[model samples]
Target chain A: MTDTVLATQAVREESPPRRGGGRNPLRHALLIALGVVMIYPLLWMLSSSVKPTEIIFRDPSLWPSSFDLGNYVEGWTALGAPFHQYLLNSAIIAVGCIVGNLLSCSLAAYAFARLEFRGRKLMFAAMLVTIMLPIHVLIVPQYVLFSQLDWINTFLPLIVPKFLATDAFFIFLMVQFIRTLPIELDEAARIDGCGHFRIYWRIIMPLCTPALATTAVFTFIWSWNDFFSQLIFLTDQDLYTVPVALRSFVDGQGATSWGPLFAMSIVGLAPIFGFFLAGQRYLTQGIATTGIK
Target chain B: MTEPDRSAPPGGALSLASPPTAPAPAAEAPPAARRRRGRRSQRAVRDGRVAYLFLAPWIVGMVVVTIWPIAASLYLSFTDYSLLRAPRWVGLDNFAEMLGDERLVSALGVTFTYVVVSVPLQLALALALAMLLDRGVRGLPFYRSVYYLPSLLAGSVSIAILWRQMFGTDGLFNDFLALFGVQGIGWVSHPDFALGTLVVLNVWTFGAPMVIFLAGLRQIPVMYYEAATVDGAGRWARFRHITIPLLTPIIFFNLVLQTIGAFQTFTQAFVVSGGTGGPSDATLFYTLYLYERGFGSFDMGYASALAWLLLVIVAALTGLNFLLAKRWVFYGD
Candidate 1:
């Protein structure tokens, strides 16, 4: 499975073809082609967004002969509310979710990781089991509960559960991260008369920037892309988030604006893709480190 | 309330690494230290209070959001509770009704087929791609990130909508098929192929399990392969002997997770089929059907019953996987 000899032979045979290159060029070319195919839809969407609406499906080529910038301009104002309003709405939810998850999940993780508490092991197991609890199981009653609170068509329903640490995945992620940190720090903090909360705030929190950032980035992206919960909770158009607003472009009663839909889709992906690029290192490292262990 | 004997060593998610060998024996304990040690019982009590204080949000959420909803749904499954009216007790009538409901049965059939087909294919693709990357390739990180991009977009509405467009009659895929002199039907619309397109879509996002497999691949010591090669093992021989057994744990994890995830697929089918699970219910995923019953037709009782049924199925399948795992999943002691 290691292919050690093949690697060594490739290094020897391919080195003269190109200095510092040991991998087979054919394999590189093949993988590059496959990568392009993997990302083709994204490229197709980008190209289609600039093509004339009438000719979008008519012309299947990725490169358009003529550029029509109307899609971005029209899609922005196409829906009843301008695109920025939806962006702002999504931003609010994303930020709220990140803050909620970071504070509550880290607090819970600290308790699970460091503090010796009653029923700690059982509580931890309960949380882990709930990780597999299907969201479908909760939707009806949650919807009913929110409706009874008169929170239908409101951001509160979409955002409040996040604040209460409803996502156990992040809690588990943080617990894994905290476990990797040495326990002696907490012991030393205690020797200096720092209470559990103080050690958590002053010591563990400072050392947990990477894990917290992972939690924040993931929460932001997940909330930003969340469609079902937002679709169900926010019925009014004016309060629509990005995903909800984007859905409206397709779900319009009349002709669908394929051009604008693609255009807005690209626009919607910008921030998330940007965040992913910025946080890619931590994201990959975090998953690679914790997922195996 | 007591210290709970930390000397016994903690367990669960936190203690993947064994608890630190009971603190090195104290060589220079004084009376002042002994007095402080006597206060350790008080400290455990204090930690308990502090732990609950920190855990208040999760505790409250588990009750109100999770436990209550699960309990209520279990009850509502047995009672007719439309939003406008109080629930009327019906006992096992909903489950009995399920026996006769063709759509519910078809939905289960659809869901089962999806799980059975998608999980293995996805895992195989993931393992294949992971092996490709594991070959010590150049620029592997870039390749990994690009490949992983799709998994990140897996459940996004935009991607589903894009998939719908790409599989439409005049879409990119059909156009590409025309180049091959093959006539292609509307993939997302044709009853025969709508589920197939969803299956392909599910398989296409194999990056997640691929990554997990890569991580697992890294865990296998290279020395084993060196030893195998020294014994005259070839590529296939080494893979069969050294890789498969060691990687089974990760494979099992991916299998269980992906199976559960495939069973709950909603947004893609919902978006592709325009939230109706249409084209004669060919694309009617289980969750989509549940949504249709619960919110669409307001058959809350039936939907609640379906929800419980799904939970039971998932639990049983997961339990089954665990039981079977003992036979196949190799843990290096």
Candidate 2:
């Protein structure tokens, strides 16, 4: 049945290409053309990062004239601290958010999906409203609250919220996923003397690997790429995440370091690009099934 | 809060089609229907206890992390509070000031223009590509991954940075135009074209909505298309008659979600315009303006008021879409 999911992710299913109009070659030609337009900017950046600074714009060819490795080396230390410091900061936050979303969102999802507790429907509706609420409305007061707590310039303001399943989107995703599992498994577990916690922890969670992976992957990407909150919170240079550090380069040392900036831009995008190559299935199916970006 | 452009929102919109608002996702429903064995007081009590135990962190988080901030923001919007000062009661002053604020009005105009222009273009591209690819292309996954790559990273600082360079005076765009002996202005720095570049950037990442459209298209039984063709319907006729009506829900869904996402754009404008929304504020997105007010100047009260304005605008627009959706969004029984 889950193979139906594989089908929807668009490539894994072995469904035959629709047979019609005898226009297969034309379709293939158009796709290749569009694909090149889609990927050109990225390829340009990748090549420009390795090109000599003076020739970056002059040589518009995607293949660089000279494969200079200086940009990567220079950009590494160009931001005052080494680039790895920023990456490490981002990694710490992403790991914290992933573990937080997995643990908190799953528990909430289970309650919403299977348990018939009092106020479950009401709580679920309230959670949905949270999803619809724009973060702009909350950021000011949240900044105020964090400042009052003296949590600004620390990852506490960023990492701590996820521990509470504040990301209702993941909870909503997991609830939809958990509802698909056969209830007979829970019924049988109940008959065998398993309680709700046991059924949730042992039975349901093991079956939710796909949903968990979805939450984890998205948490990492969003946290790693997140700018607004991070920009506001991490003003101290030492606490800068990748996004903040990248912006600083644009602000302070932009003109002389075009090549280095592109290098760092490539560096910032690599983990996610590599992540896409690795977890393409999870990323696409996550969107395809959830009808989300 | 998760970034606006990625996956945080729109996913919420999908839940509108799911439980609490509609029937359960039709798996194991019969057993759930038959289970009158539930609702016994002892079982109910035990279930509630266990469920709350599992839900402890989420419940606490919801109140402290989400609800508290929302309530505080609403309250803050009504006061003259700056950081390090007591929040002075100034009911309606902040709202009153917004009317006379030129930057606020410019921000509103810029945001509305962005939402109005970029969304339809993006969704139209998405629907067009989805239709083209849904016709069974070879390497569908490869095409999808290549296309979807930008949507995933478009919200990042790197992409925004690249966008700035791509339109800079000596950037690749001008270089491309140079080949035709046509003079290319610095698009990123040009007030006339700064927001246009951003609009083009939004339209470029049509892959996300396209993927959703593909999934929705798959849900349409091939037999319908087959029958239509057998009855002598042409390709355009089949799409107009069959595909259009059936695809309306997905179209409306993308419209609302994308509109909301576009309105919240900050990183692109912040980066492309060098945190000034400059070239004379042509690309000053509303969120960018809000960030400038709240963080740049530390005007928490006015910023909070601006935040509420954004929330209401989004909510009203979403409400309006649902109302308009009834006129056109179709559901097949």
Candidate 3:
């Protein structure tokens, strides 16, 4: 009897029918139409990247009169700074940020989550307050500081602070994930004569792989897409990231190459999309838990 | 170091309590057992030092990078500190100038309008899509991945480039419209429509919020819906009474985050306006204006002031959100 009631509850929850079956089909059709509308620009961009300049403006709807791979080749060479150099620069900064964040954030998160220390709650709240502080406010002084240290035009300004527990959002995320772990594991490790650091490394770090992966993926994406910072710091053409390099393709004067610019953009986004597809499960679950909390 | 005599009278008496156990002979006793144990305890104390040792790199980075830069920025906002020379003391000049600047006023207006319009529209679209996907739909994961693809590529330089094309005069949007005998205007170049194109782009990447909404919807008890259904509540009535109220907190979360994000929008404006805030500076956002002043005009002092003003505006908006959430957000607990 209870089973039947529970089954009915599930069915009703899944499908709560309203008035007019006639209206249902209309709503469904409208949703599909909206989805296509949302995706159309992306499809159009993909289609435009392969078309020749004539067809680009003339026959915009044609998939391509012929497959022209020249656009990618020309775009890559026309970057002034080699396209591979920009990709290399982006990779170095992103990887450095990921490594830094993983080590520092996880440690800070473990302390905040499990350790009983003086001023722990206060420190955590201070970290949270930093999130509200806009990055724009700090840019001028940060530039001055880097200039003084002779660090301008280098990746250090972009890559080094991340080694600190600077991004409080990710730290808070790690803290919450650590809190959900069973405390009995810590107690058992302690009983076996394991110290706090040992317990964290041997037990907690291993279990927190999914959270770490999420943080790494997000940091990689953010670092890769960072435009303003790269523009400000790296003035030398050789040190430019992909975004800055792509911007250089458009002369400030009248000349603008739509075909090559679009082509480079497609190439630039390939790695990020690939990364997202590979680790999307962890990313979704991480975001869900983070938002719900 | 003399060891404790295990065969002594008290040791023998202690062992006698357990008949199966016998005290070790004194001749076989180690000479420094107590000393060794004392040394081992000291070693354990030394081993406890590793925690701070492992954390030293982060502490150094915090002091030199994060903490110092923030302190310097706060101090620099008070002084005339262009990059070429040493900063000179100037009290409140930057802030006072900002109050009278018409460009700053218009930039703030544009930014607030962008935030106010884009955030709610984005969240509403996200919630609607999430609800559609929550119905045990077939190919749920595939639909989700497709919907989420835009967000993954949302803030890239490429998306901005793509947006420029899609909204251009002779671009695909115009072509699509021409089929219906409707002529299209230059969406990116026209001052009236440039900001609107950005808002549409902001709204298009509603995947992150939608995913969050989907998770929140999943947590609402199925029994509540069943009870409402059994009471003969219609679909619209059930959603209005139960879904919206229960989902308010998550909606509030998305509002605060998206508003902050929208205010910091720089990429689309930078790329679309070709980094010049073209056609009478209509696409000049707060951050874009900041970039122009600091980098374009080389006025670091005024830009620093602008940055602080942005910080204050964001803080005020967030504070307002927290104040209002109490009245609307329904916590299940």
Candidate 4:
């Protein structure tokens, strides 16, 4: 079955030369130019973050005339809430989301993949339909619900539902991954007098490390970058995430300090870049697998 | 969670009929042990109750958290519920008010226009890039990752901040325009160009669809192209006859997904317009309007109504696309 699937994929790989018939050198140059255009803004931001405030707008090029690392220190201290506290809040929320998503999603995925139950197909379909539901529809009601429970301004709004499998997309992804594993291992564990929970904890979880890693990376990035929910739920400046705190750099009176804002922006995005680099291998594999399916 | 018995009444008959295939070890085992095993299997089937036990939290969560909130929002849309007071039964008053509300009408208009214009342009750009990367080019993976980097950072607040700098007065975009002997209009500051800047931002994140398109492009059979080439078809002709037809389904998929996404856009406009949807509310997208009503003004009832309207609009558009796709989206059956 696997070979057949691979063969079909191979057959599908053989198209798309008609539009790529231009001169190779010109095409390569154009592609590189496009990449540079796309990447230059980021490079500019990184360079400007280190430049002194007076020279930021003065230099229009990709590189700064001189590097002044004081911008980082100044920006960090000048933020309304200490940058470190916001960073800590972001880290806690992100890590909590990751842990909650993995445990709840993997358990649900395993059950959906391996167990037989009534209404399984209907329940699965309902889960998929939720993906189509626009999130804006849920915000007000969710806010009201959280407020009634007195969970406002607390991490409960962000981290609690994840532990209960609130997001079904990750669970579906885990289900698809778990379904590809062989069933014989489960049967063998059963014959040895093990139960379903034991099989899940001892055998299934260990084997699905790659999927779990992918889930963790994605959940971390998403929760870290989440601004809308953070903006709504956290009113206190001390409770802000990095993204929320960064917005305060732009004065509502139309005066934005480009140097300090960009500096803080770079600092904010550093962890995401670090995380992506650290998990590059697993991320690519996960993208290739989940995307194709 | 239940296991099927392999040596009960039906199993015994099957075992007797297929005795040759039945394991000799099972036959040598005492009848009492075999019966015990059968009973154990039956018990496993009957008492496989832990499956639901494992799923209990998620089930309760779906009910209390997701389902209840959705139902509450649906009911709230028909009432007048400002955050300050108890909800009053207004009975379609919010919807009626929305119809006559000029700001809401224009927000929907602006949102529809953004979705209609951006989705196709983005997909076309993505497909073109995907085709360029599919030529077995060296450093293919690196280029793919570079292109995909924008998507990873696309929706973040930092990118929105970066967008303001790029399109603001005296920004890089205007500086580039200067070299071409053309003056830059206020891209993000002027009401006329504010929405255009947003469209550009939406177009910039074509990387995700481009990756999907690359995967889809790889799936096409090379023999079909060879056959077309042998028939003396030129590059353009081959593309017209073969590539375009095969790529329709993916295009349709991207179109639907991107449309749904674009209609719900909030952050870029919120950040660019300074969270006020200003420059005469030209950049007031649907969700941003919803945010203004629900959060900024605390008009929960009206916002709920608008939210339901957006859900309907998205679902209707997606449904319409699928219905039309029957005619255009070719399957490889």
Candidate 5:
């Protein structure tokens, strides 16, 4: 970042932009310093996950003298059940959400983006409004409703809403994506005697892969990391998702085992970390596109 | 619903609709043209039905999940609804209770401080770093990914746990302070500093805004900057005059989002303070208090009221920002 933007920006405005690629070591120093500060905690945690327990905090140097999987082994079974059970629970919810968002949201989005329908404008506006409605307002009533339906302590409450296309944000994202596809494609399909469902399944779905991937990845990550809802819905020890189980790690008496705690925390974050690495293009690009008008 | 509307006044509608246009479909046009017209109308009618079919899931979700719950939440706010028993209406009591609630006031204070202080700092860092990364730089991808990692992990319990220990008495922050011969207090436990640490934690995850700002900067046509440069505009002048005005919408977008998100922040405060929002209630965020009231104590009615208040505050602030944005947020058009 030496040739980066900062070049005594406040004082040297008159300096030619870039200074002919001159190395502004000072700018590199600043960014590097901040970057190190930004990542130090994570590095420390990663390092401690492998290091012995006695010197975990005694040495926060982000380097391990010993390569030990002992903490990981201990953390896995430290809870009554193995920690992977929580990971599995989180994965089940994530998979359900991903499938739900992809199927239901894309269908609704195709209608909004390509079809002519009565009440389309009104429905679109309603969907947008739900985007801003705080989840808190819906929480109490939803809890009550779910409890009445006998869905408490079950994944149904967490997973059912997605099947109904309740995650309006994804619908909006897919709508934006589908709208960008040429209308001629749909017209061409219609000329071939294809109906709306056929066109949605064949023409539009194939073209909206990026947007669909974005929705799927986001749903996976959000469901994987979801807290308040899961905390409320899941009470049984066998049903705990990664986030809830990790919180239990803190609330329980074994929280003092810092090494195991950090190890399990890292385990919990693994899938999300992997998804971020693999689908970062979708993640960042999706926000860039969806966030703007 | 759409299908019924198309046929509700069947004979009168078709007769009334057609006479003014064609007089008689059978007699007015050539056979091919008439067939095409008939097919097109059929297609139009089918579109309405197909639209509803496509929208079926969303309509159900909206009705059963969102709309009903919103209504129920409003109703619950005015009642004494405990899970163990039936709801008993007590109009205005929940709202009145909030007015006199000390912890609610303090919670509001804590929430506002977090929002006001953290959101701006986060956006400022985001924008500044965005500006830096906007210019052609080596290893841009590396830096972007490194920074964006936190935002991905920001809401996760893992990060929250990391944050707690990072600010604990023997945590890394204090250890850093130790290098300077400075005796560091337990930042997460100190009443005055608990919220501040959370503020810093919030700022640490400014990556999403940074990425969005970077994208918005890229969208500005290069011609604008070049034109400014030719006009003897210094870097400062170009940035201040050209960039700020153009990027206002993105800035406003990030501001509005960060503020709304900050108002609802739960995980960090919850995990940091061990779900107590403690250190003498110094870190008791509004949602944390709501969680305590609703789930911890089963004050469902009062909790609903608090939730509604949150909704109102978020809506008001967002609306106010939109109004304010007209003066500052410039559309490229």
Candidate 6:
């Protein structure tokens, strides 16, 4: 859902030019300047994280003269619970979401795309409309529901809906991907005495690697970065995800720990950065195709 | 009801992969086997049952998590529910109260301003960058990837903290401004500039739309540019006549999507304003206000009303975008 490239056909022929030419240097120079401006904050964060707390404001230079590792050590235990615990919590949520979304969404997508069922079209349409229903509308009622179920302060509120395939976006993405696949494979399998479930598991699922990868990457990132839900539900300090834990450092206290906060901030962003770097292609590809199709 | 066809379509690859759970076919049965196997009457019912089985999780979730909450919230909007007490019916009271609530009014104003200022700016920047990148730049994907990084970090608490620090009175922005002998205000704490800083933040994440714009730009046939050049059309003419017209659909799409997103913006304002949506509620986004009412003050009923109000606004805006798009958005079909 990130971007929709309305006409992918237009740019397919033009490979990125390898050799530089007239005016290219100026274009490169302009791009370089913009890139520096864009990336400076991240560099500044990295610089500030290593700088001594006293010099952080005074030394505005991105390349800090002094390197202090104390911030990293201090930030770990800054919020009573160790930073590793928060990372572990985020990891658990992300992993749960990935597994749940992959399994449930793909199952539902298969039904919508391949299987003929009563109310299939109607159900699919209903799911599409839900995409427009803002998360704001659900926040209050969901909070109340979770509280009433006595599931507050636990991962259940965060993780349970994922297992139920509540994310229609991914389901729609997988359905689109599944439809593009050859139906002849299913027919051949059926003739060979393969049942629907067997065909789904062996034939369809195997062929949907790209779509599944996109779903997994997005689910992991979104779940890991989900602050609002985790913040509301997991009131316990120990159960806080990375984003929630990061918020505690900047809770408008009298004496804010800027150094450790910046340090932990870098640490918290590391996984997402790493994930993006690893799955950058798939992430953009997913976003590009998911909505447009 | 459609039946599952047993035969493959013409020109299909007949090479079948090994199926994990394949059942043994009846070797001796012929016409009876065909009758049993070709039971097209049962196929529709069987497929329907299996489809539901596969869709079970989503069906349950739709009812339990999504539908129920939406219905409950709609009901709660007309009630007086706090977390502690059972909801009492109060028809139109909550909505009526919103008419006079100064903070809620300001919150809506702040949110509308944020969306108005940010979405277009972000999309403009995105389209600009995309046009530049579409010029057969070397390592285009690499540059695209780098630009997209900011969007990945956008709306994170860490980024908000970093933003506040960067824009503080004695922060990096001020220090940078010192080189030009200009004094900078504490952008986050200053009411006049707090919303501006958040707007800057929203604009910084233009990478998402930029990539999409790049795709849209790519969709514009190079032949159009070539033809324009043959007619002695300059760069600006070609862009105005060809690119803009062709890219309108994407522009419209991004506008609608980004508007909805900007309207829902909460984390940036929340974290920047220290979760108070202040320096005098200057940065109190509608979502943040709803959150504060629902969680901070435990006024669930009013919050639900506010939430529904947001949904209505977004839906109306989206609907309007579609109606307006008819005048401008050109599909190449």
Give the DockQ (2 decimals) of all models. Answer: 0.35, 0.47, 0.27, 0.36, 0.37, 0.40
Candidate 4: segments with Cα more than 4 A from true spot: A1-23, A285-293, B1-48
Q: What value does DockQ give for candidate 1?
A: 0.35
lDDT of 1 at B150: 81
Residue A16, candidate 6: Cα error in Å is: 7.5
RMSD of 3: 11.3
Comparing to the true complex, what docking class would candidate 4 get? acceptable
lDDT of 4 by residue, B57-150 (tens): 6777788778988889999999888867899999989988987999997798789889988878888898999878875576666777778777
Q: List the residue pairs that clash in candidate 5.
A: none
Residue ranges of candidate 2 with Cα displaced over 4 Å: A1-17, A21-23, B1-41
Tell me how far the alpha carbon of residue B65 in candidate 5 is from the true structure, in angstroms, after superposition: 1.0
Q: Which residue pairs show backbone clashes in model 4? A: A12-B218, A12-B219, A12-B220, A13-B218
Model 2 lDDT per residue over A153-218, tens place: 999999999999999888887887898799999999999999888999999999999889878888
Comparing 1 with 3 on DockQ, the higher-scoring candidate is 1
- Give interface RMSD for all predictions: 7.5, 7.8, 13.1, 7.5, 8.3, 6.6
lDDT of 4 at A215: 85
Q: Which residue pairs overlap in candidate 3's backbone?
A: none
User: Which lDDT tens digits does candidate 1 get at residues A1-293?
Assistant: 12211221222232122223338798788778878888898889889999978998878888888998899998899989899999999999899888899998999999898876556766788887887778898888888889899999888987788878899988887787787789999889899999888999999999989889888878877898788788778989889999888777777722357888888888888888888898876666555533311
lDDT of 2 by residue, B51-132 (tens): 7877899888987878888788889889998797999989999999998999988898888998899999999999988888
Evaluated with lDDT, which candidate comes out highest? 2
TM-score of candidate 6 on Cα atoms, chains taken together: 0.90
Model 1 residue A179 CA deviation in Å:
1.0
Ten residues in a row with the worst lDDT in model 3 chain A? A1-10
lDDT tens readout by residue for model 1, B1-333: 222345222232233223433352333568786566547636666676777889999999888999999998899999988888988999999999999999987798888988898879988988988877774688887988988778777677778878888898878898889999999888888988889888988887888778777767776667888898889999899999899998887788778778878888987888888887889998888898888888888888888999899889999999999999999988777
Q: Which should have the higher lDDT, number 1 or number 2?
A: 2
Q: Considering chain A alone, what is the TM-score of candidate 5? A: 0.90
Listed per model in order, the count of residue pairs whose N, CA or C atoms clash below 3 Å is 0, 0, 0, 4, 0, 1
RMSD of 5: 6.6
